[model samples]
Target chain A: MITMTRETLFNLAMMAALILFPLWAWLADEPFMITLATKAVILALAGVGLNIALGLGGLVSLGHAAFFGIGGYAMGILASHAQNYTPLIETPFLIEGTKSMPVIWLVAVICSGLAALAIGALSLRTSGVYFIMITLAFGQMLFFFTISWPAYGGEDGLSIYVRNGFPGLNTLDPIQFYGICFALLALVLFFAARLARSPFGLALNAARQTAERVETVGISPYKLRLTAFVVSGMITGLAGALFADLNRFISPTMFSWQTSGEIMIFVIIGGVARLFGPVVGAVIFIALEHLLGGLSDYWHIYLGVLLLLIVLFARGGVIGTLTGREVAHD
Target chain B: MTDPMMTDPVLETRGISKTFGALQASKDISLTLMPGEIHALIGPNGAGKSTLIKQIAGGLRPDAGQVFLQGREVTGLDTPARARLGLGRTFQISALAMEDTVLQNAVLGALGASGRPFRFWRAALGDKDLRARAQDALERVGLQEHAATRTAELSHGQRRQLEVAVALTLRPKAFVMDEPMAGLGTGGSLRLTGFLDGLRAEAPILLVEHDMDAVFALADRISVLVYGEVIATGTVEEIRANPDVRSAYLGDEA
Candidate 1:
């Protein structure tokens, strides 16, 4: 048998807790708790997506909400059209809406990927604060565009009354839907793990630390960062699609910069580069929201204080504090 | 096959120049590195040795003239493109991924040369050949023992050795090195000088150094630069004898 390190053991325990917590909530007839877990899983998925860029590639994107919103809208527009039995566009190449989960996922991932390519191409031209502002600008542009776009419910947002069906599964059952989401989170976590250890990941990590060294080694940092950004956007877009389905609603708020910040917060608080850091972070954040939110109306005050503490004393983040070794120590 | 004694040279530059606003950092410098030979570029601080190296390595574009690896004009290509075409370089500063292991740094270099750094499906740690190649590179620098140690934890001299180990993975046709002995102690320089002496059999070296003793010991030919111009280029003894080189660069020390 292979020996498991403390990190691996901790990761396994966390995954188990994620699965069992929702199950126990369901058994205890707490639908609200189950829903909370589902939200955490989906949000963790988004965090995983961001971690690839922010942690691995060191590309801090403030416009990731653009991709997330694109995904939500992709699901919203397609499901809404399918429900109304309307063709999406009246062009010569007639386009129809889809209600299939697989189809929605494909569209959502593609739309976000395309949006990311465009945004990355423009934002990547500038580095550091410039990159951050350009990305935020793109997010704001998308947010306003969605508000103005009256065709798909605009500022009020679109609603999917019925959850889309996955193959061989009744997505109507809360447990089934949660299972699908949890499974996807696991799959993506697996992908993130594989990616973080791949040769590309090594090169990207090198690019993040020292572009000059990466260049002298015969690899383009620009190309690596761009690829990572696109992949990150696509994954976050997938999470957004699932999130919309879970809530049965999609709104312009999905495109807010605050969503981008929250997603980044998960990566930071958990552990920037650790595979399961975001998962642990999401759980901690949700627990804090539930526990502290009950005690005070201004919960953000506590959240801000906690974040300050983590940044000051526990800069390596929750996982870093637990392991003593840095998450970035590959 | 290559003519070691050929005048055509393995790497060459023609009239390369760069202007940083009012400051003309490098100006119309021409140089060459023949196969199986070490060509040293020696100049005092701010003599534009680094600027010329950057121009040749594609970090900075020369305001005038061209750079050639073999016979191809690569003036417009970027640094990675030049490196991909078998040109290797070592930075004066330790430009390694400090978060990774020494082995991982070498692996990245090998992956760039192998054209498979983009493979995302398989685990990078599972590639036997890649690991072996990286190990071989570390072994070349006599640092295979410390392969698994974090790069940040490596000592200064060890990091410098790791730099050469990383560069060697390129299997370069000619090396463009900038101040390889800038901060080396006596023993470190002696070891590196020995290593560099044996390395020319694999490929020619274009060395930029401040250490006159190491220069005279290793350089088959030397080019003395003064204020971004090649004041003299000749055999070590000839360069030592050149009055312009002595007055402008070497001074009374020559």
Candidate 2:
């Protein structure tokens, strides 16, 4: 007989809720709710990316917004070029722009992965506060650069008049877009779960606990962490591309430190190192914003208080508190 | 086949030296561990035993020295690289992953030994080969019963046993163990001493320890360090008789 732990059961329930709520909204003629769920799913994807590095690998990256912005820019640039009927580059050889979501996703993942390799190589040399500061500095540098650069509307941002195309689906429809985003989220979550059980994950987890012990066992913590960082950046970048397509726009705000913080908040608020932590966190965050925003403009103050409580008392976040600390075998 | 022990030392250090600003930690220290023998390194506190061990194990780079494992120079290698070269080590303080299971820690060491932990699909615990290697090591250390227990929950002595099990998974050519007998009760120490006595047949041990009784019982040879230098090196009887070693370390105990 197959048995499930409380945490596993909780994760399944959360996934079910995510899928059903949008369906319910679609049936009730509330398209805005579907859009909001899409937003939550996109943010959850980004959070999962950060969770791989921060939670499992114990790398506290404060500059993930750089990858997110790069992804957003990838979609923006390609779509803008295609919309204007201009080649992206014509200097030596012609490289055409693309309105294809798959192409944009690939470009975004590769670009962000390369960026992560460079940033992680340098920043991973230092640990704790220095690592955090270096990552934050990198994010801020990209944010300022995007604002100053005039290629894709600079601070004004870029807008795609129509959503990018998939093979056959109408991406302009909110529920269809939600379905795509949700599917990707499910796939990434599955990958993340498997990754956490792999040998690399074991070594990475051990490195997080005692690096010296890991070294004595014959694995380089630096290489392990760098690889994780690159994969993490690629996942976040994919989320950024999806987010840009959903809104039909891309902006410098995507690169802002606040975006990075929000992504981190999803991991922390859901539960650090938990597979479905980001999903629960994203849902609650969106729900709070929607419900609390109508009550007062001081919604952020309430969020700050909630964050403080989670950090102080509820160290495990919602899932962790409910399920309790997991035994090694369990 | 000719015994390699007769031709070359299993592990050797040549004129290793280290200084921190003004205080010298290790000075012109050289040592060797022959195959199938336990070489005990003993000294009073702050006599640079730990620093010398760190240099030998690749945790610290000596200012002037060369370390060789099986006649190959390893001075330039880092800890992990040296470990990959079959130089297994354990810490003075237990360094097992506290959150992981005992088997998980052993599996990790075996994974390191395999030199291919990058595979991302299959579960580590589910790997039959890795599981067998880990289980065999644990069984050798009499820790097979605690395979699923969280490492943090183990008693201090059991943690020490797990450390050896972890090192055993490396299938190492030599072992560098720092104070493996620290924090053990008398019964635990006796049992571990007996276990280590038998372990010498698998791989030579360079044991840095404080427990003289365990040292005298297990070591094939002894080296005493004092004021950043090896004051004496000899068999157990000669070490007990050496005036310099007695005064510098053993003293009244001798």
| DockQ of each candidate, alpha-carbon based | 0.80, 0.88
Model 2 pairs in collision: none
Cα displacement (angstroms), candidate 2, residue B221, comes to: 0.9
Model 2 docking grade: high
Q: In candidate 1 chain B, what residue range of length 10 has the lowest lDDT sum?
A: B1-10
Worst 10 residues of 1 chain A by lDDT: A321-330
B1-254: candidate 1 lDDT, tens digit per residue: 55444556889999888889898887788898988899999998999988898998989989899999988899999999999998999988889999889999998888888876787877666788888888899999999999889999998889989999989988999998887886889999999999999999899999999888989999999998888888889999999899898888777898
lDDT value, residue A231 of candidate 2: 94
TM-scores of chain A across candidates? 0.97, 0.98
Backbone clash pairs for candidate 1 read none
Tell me the TM-score of model 1: 0.98
Cα misplacement distance, residue B112 of candidate 2 (Å): 0.3
lDDT: which candidate is best? 2
lDDT of 1 by residue, A1-330 (tens): 667767787899899998899899989989889888998998899899888999899998888898889889999999999999999988888888888998999999999999999999888989999999999999999999999999888989888899998989999888889999999999999988889888888899899999999999889999999999999999999999999999999999999999998888888888888888788778878888998999998897887887888888887678888876665433
